[model samples]
Structure formats: C-alpha cells, structure tokens
Target: MRKHETYAQQPHIRIITGACPHDCPDTCAWQIAVDERTGRAVDIWGHPDHPITRGRLCGKVERYLDRVYHPERLTRPLKRVGPKGSGQFVPVSWDEAIADIAARLQQIIAEYGAEAVLPYSYAGTMGLLQGEGMASRFFNRMGASRLARTICATAGFEGLTYTLGAALATDTEAFAKARFILIWGSNTLTSNMHLWPFVQEARANGARVIVIDPARTRTARAADEWIAINPGTDGVLALAMMHVIIRDALYDADYVARATVGFDRLVARVRDWTPERAETITGVPAARIERLAHEYATTRPAAIRINYGLQRHAGGGMTVRTIACLPALVGAWRDEGGGLQLSTSGAFRFNRNVLERPDLLQGREPRTINMIRLGDALSLDPARLAQAHYRPRPVDPPVRPEEAGPPVKALIVYNSNPAAVAPHQQAVLEGLRREDLFTVVLEHFQTDTADYADYILPATTQAEHWDIVKPYGHYYLMLNRPAIAPLGESLPNSEIFRRLAQAMGYTEACFTQSDEEILREFVEAQTDPVFEGITWERLVRDGWARLNLPQPFVPFADGRFPTPSGKCELYSERMAEDGYDPLPTWTPPATRRNADAATVWQQGWLFCISPPAHSFLNTTFVNVERLRRREGEPSLWIHPDDAAARGIREGALVRVWNERGEVHLRAHLTEDIVHGTVLAPSIWWNKLSPDGRNINQVTPAEESDMGGGARFYDVLVRVEPLAVASEEPESTQQAVSLA
Candidate 1:
C-alpha cells in the first residue's frame, strides 16, 4: 500500500531458443520470455520459423511457462527430514547439501568400489550436453555402474540396424512426393501436430494416406482409409500385406534382385499368412487387407511413417522388423519419395561422428545392465547375487551380506523421474529406499522421485541453459541459449558435473572442458563431408543448420545398404541367430481373441495410454494450473457399449483392476475408442492418497524380452462402479479431456 511499492517492469518480450528434448515425434523449438529485472519468465511461444515445427506450439509446451514459474519449484537443495516417500523435507544450504552428497557418495565408493553406484537417466531433458553427455562423462570417470544403452528404441534401432546397417531415413520434405503414404501405428495428427500440416499437403497433392493402428485415432479419422488391427498383431498385418505383394507378383523384380538378400525365405514365410488367416487374428477384414496391399504395391513412390508406440509390446521389435521389410520388398528405396520412413530426422549423417568421438569417454569402461528390466536388476535375485562374486572384471566393492541385489549401493538420477515414469513405481521406490544406497537427484521441481532423495539438486530449466540439441526424431539442429540467469543456486547440468568432478579430485580431461569447447570438439570430428565447412559459431548464428549429404533426398540408391552383404536383408541373419524367425513372420499376441470365438471378445480391455501433447510430461506439468485445469486427472476411456455391458455410468467413479494392481479413476463413456478397448492417459500419480493414482499399478510389467520394451497395452482389467455413490461424492477422481 506504500507509495514507493511500484510493480516491477516486465520486458515487452524476450527470446530463448531451444527445442523439446523428449523422445517425442515432434521436436518443437521453443521461445521463452522473462521480466528484465525479476528474471522471471512470463511468456513462452513456439519458434514459428523453424522448418520442422513451422512455428506451432503444442498444449504441453505453451503451458510449460507455468511450470517454470510455479510457486512450488525447488529453489534450493533439500535433504530428507522424515521417512522416505513420506514427502517431508527440510531446506538446506547449497554448500551443506552438496558436501553431504559428496561425502556419502565417496563413502559408498570407498566401501564398495565405484561400480556400486548406478547413474539412472533418460529422455527427461534431451540437451546433448546437459542430459546424456554430462552423465556419461561423470559416470565413466568415476568407474560407476554400467547402464544399458537401448531401453525405449532398442528394438526399432536393432531392426533398422540389421536391415539398413544404419538407423537413417529419408528427409521429412520427401513425404510430399510420395504417391501413397502408409502411416503405421502412429497418430500423427495428435502426437505430431506440427507434421500434420505436411501430411495434409501430401493429401492435397493426391497422395493416399493409409492409417494402420489397433485403435481408430485422429489421424485415422482424416485418412483416405483406416485399418484397425488387433493390438500386438501389427506383424501379422504386415506379413499378410507382404504375402499379397509377393503372391500377386507386384514387386519390383529388378530393384529387389539388385538391392535385397533372402527374398526366397521371406516369400516362403509370408506364404502361410494369407489375408483370410490374418483376418482371424487381426480382426481386420480380408478384402480390405487385400485391397490395401495391392494399392500400396501398385502406388509408385510410397512412404511409411512408423511411430514409437508400436515398440511397447512383447513382440514390438519383431513387428517393426517385419513392417520394415515391406519397402525393401516393393523396391520403394529406389526413388526419392519411396523407402520406409520410421524416424525422418535423417541425422545419421551427423550421429556417425558422435559415435566416433574418442575423447568423449576416453578411458572409462564400466559394467552394464538392461534398462527395461530395472525392477529385476534392483530386486533380490538370489541365484544371480550368488554368482555375482565370481563374475568378471569391473566388480563393485562387496556389499554387506544383507545388502544383496544388483550392487547399486548408490544412485545419481538426472533429467528422468523413474518413480512416476518407470514401469513399476512401487519397485523403483523400494530400490531407492535401500539403506546402503546414497541417492542424488538433479531436478527442476520437487518431483515424486526427488522426494526420496538423500540430496535434491536444483537444475536450470531449458530457458536458463546454453547448449546444442540434435533431435533423435527430427533433422533440425537447435541451439539453446541462456535467456536468463539460474534462479537461486540452481545450476546447468554441465556445471554441476564439473563441480562434482572437482569435488572428487578426478583428473579427466573430458570433464574439464567448457561446454562450448566440447561442442567445438564434436563439430570438428565430422566424418560427413557436408559438415566440413560448418562451425559451432555458424550454427549459433543461424539458430539452426541442416547437414549436407551427397544424396540428401534419396537414401538407398545403387543397391548398396550398410549391411554386411551390402544389400537389404528381408530375412535378417542376425535375428535368426538370436533364436528368432529370420524372415518377417507373424504370431498372435497372447491378448488377441481365438478363431473359434462366436463373438470377438478380449480377456481384458486393451489400455492405450499415451503422453498428452498438452498437459502431460510424467509429473512435470501436474503443478501447472492452466494445464491441470484443462486436464484435471486421468480418466479411463471406454466405448458406450462396453460401459453399458458393464453396468457402468458416465462420470462415475470406476475401479480398473488387473493382475498387477488396481487404482480408482473416473469412467468416460465415448465411441471414440473401439468397443473392447480402453484408453488411459499415462503418468498420473497422487501424493495425497495412501495408494497413489499411478496407472502402472494396474499395468503389467511383463517384459517384451523379444523387443526389449514393456507390453503396456497387453493389460486387461475389469471395471466396476464404486459401491457407495453419493449425489455429490466426497472423493473425486481425476478427469482427462479429448482435446
């Protein structure tokens, strides 16, 4: 009320250039603004000029400004003041927190060699230096425990690696030139909104868009034709299509003869999977399947857009492998508009240089474990524990007899929140609470995972950091510049690692270089002649840069694949060696209906949980009022017929229970979903409830050992209304919106 109490002056606008770092299909470039003096970001928008994103912002990114400015963001480091998972903590000075963390880590390393510590991270933040590089350098220098290289995209990469010898795809611009576009297992309109415009353009040019998915999605609604197959039955549909292509003699004989190997075996394997046979398993009609196969084979210059969701099944890897064989079989790779496109970023031209970096992790070689099987790795495997002592080199110092398991005496978590994002939340929590394990989490907020940490380090948001981000799913090379200073004692991930290295008294040159210097070193090691004249400064000035390649448009011309045989292998020998069918084959997932069933019925409804493009990023966006208001809580989406059959009402409290676990939520009755399937938005956990609202509770953690991913959709659950329902219920479940 005082006369001098004037409001602080906010900047008219500010700009910070960076891109979303998640493993999402749309790698968006963002612009953030802050008040000149207060150093508080007030507005955030999408970079309209970026070629890939074309200046569009999704709901999640638009509301992200609220997340950075949220009142509950961890401004300083903290130490646990109560029992783990109790959500009680006391603020501590940065010095004390860092010192305490360093002491505990050193003690653990001294008592049980450095390998006792495990550094867990993932696509939480995709900054090249901040996320992967910093963690890799710190862990390697300390001789920390090993981490499995591929968790999310292993199968997709492995499939492409063997077939193409490299995981590269044609450019996104080439999609317009295609005569037929096969969109497989990807909801491009909703999941990749920016790319939707491009597809619309392609459609305008008379290119037919064929959507193939288990559920009818937004993209399917707009497609020229929609093919709804059973979940996990994608391989079957792909094989059936191949059968029609081979049997009818629609293939490009000269192209196939020159560029491919093992055609006879692939032809033989697909012979039995006729459209009629596939119809029984996939639930898609035989006539439509035959029509699509013919159309795709006859349509010259066809492109396939494969999404990452398909890999989340037991046979996901094999399904991708099977589907990848189609383009090769039809000789689609011979044209610029042809060739199967899984991830169209076309960054393999640059990624080759990154893999060849000798100074990146010079002398560090540590033991490794599979990332998908974190629960098993942390759990007490008595037999494996007994054999642990006799196992080879790089062993962690022995733990006490009682402190058994996979020797993770300490953990350093960065970017990722496994407590909310991992398959089994309870198991991850239990592993983190190990008495002997010292935990340190670098986070922007007080997340569920950070709540249990021995020390919680505040990290700079994308707006408060400087680095270069090369998207895994897109071709744009983004330059992230610091628009504002770090809030409170928050630090960039790179600086944090540097300080940690100094604290540990380690002499590793890789850890000593400045961020710019490291980037320069990487830019100089370019094996791709296209980048021969480019520099880091040039990239920063341009805001973005495209790598030049000899044949930038077409990838597999001249019949020379990167495979050992220099030809695309429809029947991969590597898959055969791994005890899998060499030729692309199909088997019904355990979840599908039997042929004898009078009516098509599923044991449990398929749960298609996807990350909301707007208000969902694990636990990060839950605190944003606008986004949270728009998408209140998780809702179980069911078809009207299914709800009527179960005697369930709309907006009623429903309990969805499966073999793994059960959580209470609200039921949304709509015809948007298939009759027998259910859709739940993933990454919802309630801190207030004794039993949290995590969907993983009901999600089975059954490993798709074949694919190296989780079969999240394979779960079937029985839904029922709450026994006691008041007109105005005291307890309200979370609600999600279709928008």
Candidate 2:
C-alpha cells in the first residue's frame, strides 16, 4: 500500500494507521488524520477494512484526542520537591533525570542488592513494544526483583488452562450463529463493545440471551432474561446446572464419553449439587436453575461469554473451571458459536522470549514479588514477606531474608496506576509515601501513582509512537505507526527504557536497536504457524493482519484438545497435585465465610463489588473532563431495601467501611442491585474523589485460589448515612441503574 495522502490527493492532510494501546480486548485498528503543516492530529477513526472493529470506535476512544491534547499532559521530567503524595514537582532536563536516576539505582543496588529494586506495571498499555519490550530487557539486565504481574485475569487464565489446555475460546465473530447465549459476569456493552454487535446479530436471529450476575448491568438489561445470583456463588450455580444436565439425561453422552475425562468421577461429585441445594447457596430459584440447565443442554449452538470479574474471589478459578466444563458435556464445540468464550489470547503466540530478552539475566534468579501484594512487597519487613512464586495460592508462613531476599528500596512504575487500582488502598498509599523508597514513574500525566514518584518522566501516547498490539478477544495483530510528532519533550516508553540502559553504562548492542528494528526481530522470532504470512513488512503495509486460522474456527470439534491427555480434562490431575479439588467444586468467598466479630460486628454488613465504571477503563480516562463529568462523583449503588434499612435515601452521602478502611460515596438506591449487596463502579483517583479514597479502601489484598490473582470482589462492608445533604436533586421518575 502507498501513502494514504497521495491516494486522497490531499497534500496538507496525511493519514496514518495505528492501534488503540489502552488495556482493552478489542484491539481496534485506527486511522489518524494529521495536518502536515502543524503536525497535529485533526481526526481519528477506526480502520474501515478491519473485520472486528468494523470502522467503529468505542465511546472512550472516539474522544481520545482530548487525552492526547489535554493541557495537563506531562511533557518533561520533573523532580518531586515536596512530601510524597503532595503532587509538588520542579522541571528537570532528560539528561539530568536519567543520570540522577541511574546513580540512585546503582547506590541502592550496591547497598541493598539488586533484588531490593522492584518494577511494577500492568496492562495500562497493551502495546507489545511500548509496554515491556525495552523495559523488560532493562530490568532483566539489572537483576531486579521480578514482578509476577498477576493483578488481573491470571486466575481465570489458569482455570482455562487446567480445563481446556490453554486460554482458548470460541471465535468472537461466530457468536452471531448461536441460538442461545449466556453472558455471565461480563458487561459486554461497556468493557467489550466490539463483540456486542455479534451478540446483537444473534439476538436478531431469535436467540435467547440470558445474563447471570448480581447486578443488572447494561448487558443484563439488554439480555432476554436476567437471573441475579449471589456474588462469588458462580461455582455453585455451575455445579447445580451440571447436576440438572446429568440427572435429567439432557447432556450429550456420546460427545462427553469421547471428548472428556473423569466423567464417572464428575457424576458422583455433582450428584449432591442439586438445584434445590444450590438455590440455598446461590440465592437463585431452583426452578430457574433447572430451566437454565435444560435450555442450555437442549439448545444446539449454545454460547457463553464469561469475563474475569467472576474470578476475582477465593473460588474464582474453580468457578471458571466448572463453567468451562459445561460446553464439553453439551457437545457445544461441535458447531460454530456453540462453545464458551473466556479468552482468545492463546491463539496469538508472539515471540516474547526474544522481545523481552530474559537472557540478559545471566543465570541470576531474583526474588519474585506478586503485583497484587505490592503494598506488602514494598512496606513489609524483608524476612516477613516470604518467598513469592507464581502459585495458585499465597505462600504460608514466613521465610528468612536469606530466602525471601531484601525489602524493595527502589521502585519503577509504568503503564499502571497502582495507588488507585491495587487493593488495600490505605496500605498502598502508605507504601508509596515512604521517604526511604526511591520511585520512578514514566507516564503521560501526573497520575495518582506518579505524584509519589522521585522522578516523573513523560511518556508518549499511542498517536506518537510505534508499537505492535495483540488482541486477547480477537485474532488480529495490529501495527501502530506514529501519526504525529511527540508532543513537547515526551518520548515513547521504549525509548525511555533504552536511554535508562545507556545511562547505567550497560554495554549491550540490543539496547541500541531502534523501535522498528526491535519490532522486526520480534516478528521474525515467531515460530507458530499462526504467523505463517503475518510478517512485520506486511503489517507495516496493511496496518493489521489476521492470524492464519481456519475461517469460522472450531478448535475442538474433533475431540482432540490441546491438553496433555489430548482431550478436555473434566478432572485435572495437575489440579489434584496442586492440592485443589480435581473435580469442579465451589469454594465460598474467604472474606464472607471467615467473617469474624471484629470485621462483621454490624448486622447490616453488605457484600460489596467494585467493577469498573462505563466511562473509565480502570484509572485511565478519569482525567478527561467529559468522561469524568459523565461518571459524576464516585457513588455507590444500593438496593432500596438495604438503603432504607439503614436510613440511607437516594443521593444521600454514605460511608462504606470495613476493617481495612472506609470510603465516602453518594448512595443511589435502586433495584438494579440485589438485596444485601452494594455495587460501586470505580477505580477513581484519590485526588479527584471527595474523601481522598475509592472502593479499593474496603477491598482486601487477598489472593484467590488460583494464579494468585487479586480478590477485588471478595469484600464485606457496612453502609450508613453520613448525615449530609444530597449533592444534587434526585428524580424518582428516572431509571436508577446504568441504563
């Protein structure tokens, strides 16, 4: 393909193709119209030729220009001049900042060992190059403490792997052919907007869409039927469904016998999980549960869309594992759009080994720290923190310093805002406020995490960088080209890490490689057949390319799964070896089951869940004035019965408190949420909120049963009116949910 401007016959306007770098599953291929004269982006739109995005941008990405051109965007390196969390800073040149940062890092390494330095990051930017290409090399060379990076969907990933062999799923585009769809624990309209179109097409074809969640989210309301269940009781519901399917002889017996293992053991395990028994545990009616199971088994081409929200609890992994077994029993994999969709990430086998360059470690194995335990990893005593590893559960008992290594004395933060998103907000804030901890943040703005940094280096946005993005929900690999010049003194995250490596006097030739050169090497290193014709040059020419997969791909149609047994593991021996139940079982939420008198002293304690808001993707887009105004102030959604029981009326200021901490939020009474449960759509920045806190204050830094993921939804709190007037007028006539 030639330059787009030449084809359009426009000399002043040049169009460049790029990919959305935010932490989203829909890696939309986008085009930016830049004014050549002023070097400014004039317009942006989705790639019309892309199959998944289909020339449509999400509500958030549609206004991405506001973020790139925001007046408060960081453009230079700054040194903190006041106490931590004060947001006080003075400008510094890049050379001075790099030299000072390198010196401090070296001193820390010499005094406290390289393991004392920690690098913390997450999927704030999903770009392969900008996210961790160069950063991983720098950290590996330094022998710094390794971050487990398990803050998000690791529990679900592990569950899928143990059950289905990998994080494989039904194709997103095939959802249109389904006759029955179950959108479980996912708000498709908000989080995964692109897949919603296929779901709607299925609906148009007379498919019945049922949603099973505690709150009536937008997707649920749009669904044909919304069946509310108790939070963290998904495993129980799934087991009961299996019970009904097996007991009623509705399952595909031939398919199950040939395609799955441990059928005999699974039968005995789910025998006692009757709908009546599960009704007591899940708060869903027995008849409805039985009907759901019947419909699911009887309906040919049934599809399920489960997200990571359900796996943010003690039983999260088991919940996903149990649900992943349903498709095999019903023989859903035999047809297109008939299986479950948890994640399609396993399909894109990128050459991360070459790109990240772990060989730079030189045989040194540094202490590992879990990102979910960032507060403890940073603030706890060295000997008390224990030896961290990538396990399904937290390490028990403490290990000595000789085993666990030293405390984190230096921190590097990029791509994520841990201060706002991490659980146990107070502890994270405390850790960030430590005077002895040296922190460096590379960001586009002074985020909640950046305010506590010893040095803040400006990072470029997606419009001004080169990157390759892989989608977790689809099968396309996108290439991002620079649409406009870097604003002010801002640079790409890859460049920043490259310069840091140079300042450290590291003599590695890989550190001098350009972004495009690194990208080409990354592309060439791919050995998977999925990359057959997907070359770096092709990506540069076409902007995006689909994986070389079969059209309407049905992966397990022949009963040949990718598991060790060559079939679906209904009962995983690996799980049994790891001290987990081999067959699917429900493990109640730890916080709820072990609520002591001290934590649950009051009778009005409500199960609280803090899902992301529609306008904000974690902490991103919160600084945008339009999105923030649309989100309004941080508010809690409560049932009218629960709110009235505590004298909490609509729009009244209320306090949601637990043993960890308390957060003040306005109460919006609605039937959208179930009784005895409160919903707070969040990840709001502390500085912008009314009480300098968010929902994470009440969320514990607890790990789930698998993949050591954060239990963000496993929280119990008491809600009470704060004796303040409503901030604005309330209208009883309006709908009370996120309609």
Candidate 3:
C-alpha cells in the first residue's frame, strides 16, 4: 500500500485513492481528501481517469463524508439491555463483547452442532476483503450451514448464462456509438447514474432511446419514448417481439445458422406468441409492439440495457433468457455497440478459492438454506426440517433426510439489513424476536436489523478499511486503501471476524491474515489473462485498472459463446436438465392480473412494485437525514382514477394491505404509473416509517423460477384512505380496470 503523505502546496491535506465499497454497480474509483492533522476525511470525489466514472459521483455518494463522520455512527460495541426490537443498549468493551459472543456460539455448537450456526450477509459492501474474505473462511471452517445468498441478481444472471453462455455483454463505453438503445426495466438515471452519460452521448449522436417499464421513472420521462407495460409481463413482450422478428424475416439468417443452436425450435415456439396475444397480457398495443420489433431488427448497432428489476418475478429468469435471445437473433453481436448488457461481472475472473478458501469445508456437505427464505429458515421447527422446502439452488446437493440438521441457533449478520429489505417482513421480525436465537450484528449505524441483535458490533466505514472492488457494470479492478484511522473503537469487518475466530480457539493461520495480506494473496494468485497487467504496485499507484482486453471488447462477436454447444443456446438443454423449460416461455406472477377475475379477488386489487428511491440505495443511506429529507416520507404512487375510486385523496394517509401484512403510507396520486398498479419508492427503515413498517410487509416469501431469488415485485395490495385519526383504515368498494 502507498504511504500517506501531505501535499507540498497544502501541508495538512493529503489525497488518498480508494474505491467505493457500496453495493452499487458503479464501483467508482474515488479519491478522499483527508486532513492529516485532524485525521478526518475532508471530501471525496470520483477519479478523473476512471472511464465509466468520468470524474463524477452519484448524489448518494457525493455526501459520503457525512455518513462516515455522522454523529449517529456506532463507535463502540453494545450489548442489548432491553427487548430484542427495543433500541436499548449499553456500551461494552471489544474484549467483553467478543468473549461473550464466542462463549454463546460454543454453547450452541455443543448443544446442537456446527451446522446450527448460520452466517447471514449480502452486498452491504462489495469488497473482496471486507465483505466476505475472513467471514467466509470462519463459517466454512466451523462447518456451518451454507447460505445461498440469492436476494438479488442470481435469477437474471442465470437467465443470461443459459442464453449467452456467460454474463458478458457489450462494453459500456460502446453505448456512445449505438444507434438504438432500449433501457428496459431500468431507471438508469438513478440506479446507474454513471452509464447515463454514455446514453446521453448516444442520444447526441442521433440515437433513439426507449424505456420499457410499468412506471414513468425519471429515466423513462427523459427517454425518446416510454412503453408502459404491466409488471412481471416483460417475458410476454419479448416473445411478441420475437414473433414479429421471425414472421417478417427480420432475423439475421446467416448469423442464426452459424452462431446459434435450436433456432428452428425457437421459431416454432414463438409462433403462438403473437403481438395481439401479448397486447392483452402486457398492456402494450400490438401496433406499438410490431413497430418496436421492426425498428430493433432493422437498426444497426442496436443495444439493450436491462437491470435486475425485471427478474424479481415468477418468470424473471426466463424473462431475461427470452430477452437475451434478441441480440443473437438479429446479429447484434457483430457490432461493438449492438449486443445486450445485463452484467459485465463474468468478465472478472477473480480466484475466490484464494480469497474465500472454500477448501476449509474439507468436503463437509452442509445443508444450504436460501437467504430469501430467512423467515422460514429461522422459525422452522427442527422436527419438520426434513419435510420443509428450503429451496436450495439447483446446483446444491439436496439435504438427505438423515442430514436435515438442527435448527439455526446462531445468526451472525453483516453487510445486509434483512428486516427492511427482505420479503415477508412480518415473519422475519417474528423470527428476530425469538429469545433463544443468538444474533450478532456488525454495522456502522443502528439499522432495523441491528435493533434485533443480541450484540451490536461497531464496523469500520469504507474510509477506514482496505478492500479490492470489482464492478458488475464495468470491467475495472480498483483497490481501496484506508484513508483514516478507525473511528473511536470501531474495527474493520475482517478484524472483527478474525478476533471472533481467535476467541473460539481456532488455530488456523487463515484467520490471522490481514486485509492487505488476503487481497495481495488473491491478486498474486490470479492466472487469468484478464489480470495480465493488474498488479498490487500498479493498483497502489494508479488506484484502478481496466481488464486486459481489446479496446472495443465485443465478447460475442465471433459467436464462440462459452456454452456446451460453443454457440448461443436458443434452446438450452442445460435448462432442461435443471427442470426448467428448454425453450423461452412466459409464466404469470403469483399475483394474478385482472383477466383472472376470481384470482385477482383472492389476491389484492393493485399490483405493487417497490423500486429503490432516487436518494437511497436500498436501506444504506436511509439513515442519512439529508438524503432521507430529499426522499421525503415513504409514500405510495397511485393513478388518479384508482385513488378517486378508493376514496383516497392526494397526501392522504392510506393503509396498503394484503394477506401477508400491511403498511401505512401517504398516498400521492399521479398518472405516471400504469392503471391498477401502484409504485412505492423504497426501502425505508421500519423505525423511520409512520407505521413502523415498510413495503416489504406485504411481499411474500416466494422464489423466482430458477435461482431461488426473492420475488419482491411479484406483490399485490389494496389501498384505502385512513378513515379516522387512530382507527384502523377501512376499505371502500371500487372497480378499476387492470387492462
């Protein structure tokens, strides 16, 4: 690592290069201006040399200094002195906390088994070192139950893999040269702000940009056209587009013949999915669908920018698979800017074996529990464990009847806030309230999840950690050097886990590996050609480096896809073996549309989608008062007609409910959303909400088609105005068209 030195011009100021460790796709290479005298971060800005960042940071990250040095930031370990959900805790020394936590874990292991311990985590920090390096080693060595972390991206990632062989895509920089762009199911301006500049560049070059979403988002409003389709109906629209493309002979015959498999089967499969059929299902006009298909097929250098939002439904995986087939069908891969881009994550070939050290498992086949089903996993009766469906991933070996394992006795949570973000909020809180459950949370602030912890460990902020970051949106490897000393008594996550392992009497050398040592070992162990020139010294001096590839990195231009057939699989035999349909197909969400009148009545009236609010990234920055103020209060966006029928006035406090649970929110009437649908810009912390709950209360613990991913958007709820100041909100008779 580079040594920190004061600038010659300003003796007290030093600039330190680091990477943003948040869960965002844009893993920006940033420089933190630190005052060496005071040992505090002065400001942070994006690195000018980073291609995708372009010397710009998003609104949420621009004020990250406030977050790191916030008054509410946890600076000492705490032991809960009150009830589980009560925000009451007394400060404890690091030695006392670690010793007590270790003693409890050992007692649980002795009473049950090692498999009773579960480590719950996800992308709070997308860093190789701080995120999971030491924690994974610790859990694996302890023979704990494996957590299939599938809250986000797994379904869409698997879908892209089945069709395109890997999660490779057209270079993000190539978007500037595209003639046509489809911003499908993505609010690019908010979630992927860095890529918006490239989109704007394309627009300046006379390119047409279309947004296909249920709500008129900030990105949709700025697009050349917006196609309002019903939620979870993206698959039907894709199939309808293929119907027009194949029927009109707009597909590239030569490319399909040479570079794709099962094209003939795909042709017959999409024949029945006509534009007229999709019109009724997707709420898109048949004429408009036909025009979109023609334009996409004929336009050269056409590109599609899809996000993970579309894959949060019953058919999310298949929906992505169907959409991925379009680029190859039209020979879009031949151009630098033509192919579809779901993720560039596959381009990174990090040697996780060195970082995570799964070899610590030593062939222990532990039961894998899906993270999205935490509600069931925590509350499940040990006697019924054999019968319960944990729904592990297809690749995981099923737990035998004899190896059903004991109930989860210990839960160590880091990196994620499940109480506010997970589906089936009520069940999760119920599980958290269990007095027997030993829970420890490592966090910077007292988040919703932290409020339920037996012990709250103070974790280091990004400015006080050493990490290596890889972006899913771009092909860059960046390193983060600690910009300042640990605040108060806080420690990096790596050190916290290391201390726990020591307290547990673990004598493994891996447990003692420093953050820099772990990162250095992983970087040095890399053998892939992509890491050709990326070295520790280079990263220390330059902060970031792009993968060693061709300038315009067109991954699939030659059609040598990394599939079993060595070509794009129009019909995936791998999918068939995995018990999924071999060809692309549409599956309706569990929440039925209005066409199914009886089912709609059984479910709620309106379809609900809770996308990330513009000012917040999931539940990360919600605690920041400035950002929270910018987001205003948690509210539901409903169409004017639907609100009027429900006797809901604008700014009226309304109760939204379904079978699972309910939440109260102020209603904002607007035509920006589709009819019979409501939008909730989430996710608000439970304690901060007016009703002590958020949108997740109504979301079910349902899994998507392929990857056991959370189906957060596959939700339904009914909204009505609050009748009295303190009484329960009453429903009103209303009729709204779902068509």
Residue 35 lDDT (model 3): 86
How many steric clashes between backbone atoms does each model show?
Answer: 6, 0, 0
Better of 1 and 2 by TM-score: 2
Per-residue alpha-carbon lDDT of candidate 3 for residues 1-739, written as tens digits (9 for 90 to 100): 1223334357788898898888787889888988888998887888777898877899999989889989999999999999999989999999999999999999999999998898999999999878888899899888898888889888888899999888998889999989999999999999998888888999999999999999999999999999999899999999999999999999999999989999999999999999999998888999999999999999989999999999998778989999999999999999988899999999998789998889989999787878888887787665334433356345545555566778888999999999999898998898899999999999999999999999999999899999999899999898999999999999999999999999999888998888888888889999999999999889888888899989889998888899999999999999988888889889777665435534453434788999999999889899899999999999999999888877889999998877678899999999899987899999999999988999999887768887887788987677888774243334322222231
At residue 397, give the lDDT of candidate 3. 57
Cα RMSD, each candidate: 6.6, 4.9, 3.3
Question: Model 1, range 306-414, lDDT digits (tens) per residue?
Answer: 8767766656777888888888888888877777767644453654334223354457655565554455455555433332221111123433445443467777888
- Poorest lDDT segment (10 consecutive residues) of candidate 2: 730-739
Q: Model 3, which residues run further than 4 Å from truth?
A: 1-8, 383-403, 593-604, 724-739
Clashing pairs in 1: 48-55, 60-614, 113-397, 332-339, 604-716, 633-735
TM-score of each: 0.88, 0.95, 0.96
Q: In model 3, what is the error at residue 556, expressed in angstroms?
A: 0.4
- lDDT tens digits, residue span 1-87, model 2: 433444357778888889998877888989888888899998888887888888888888988999999999999999999999999
lDDT of each: 0.69, 0.87, 0.88
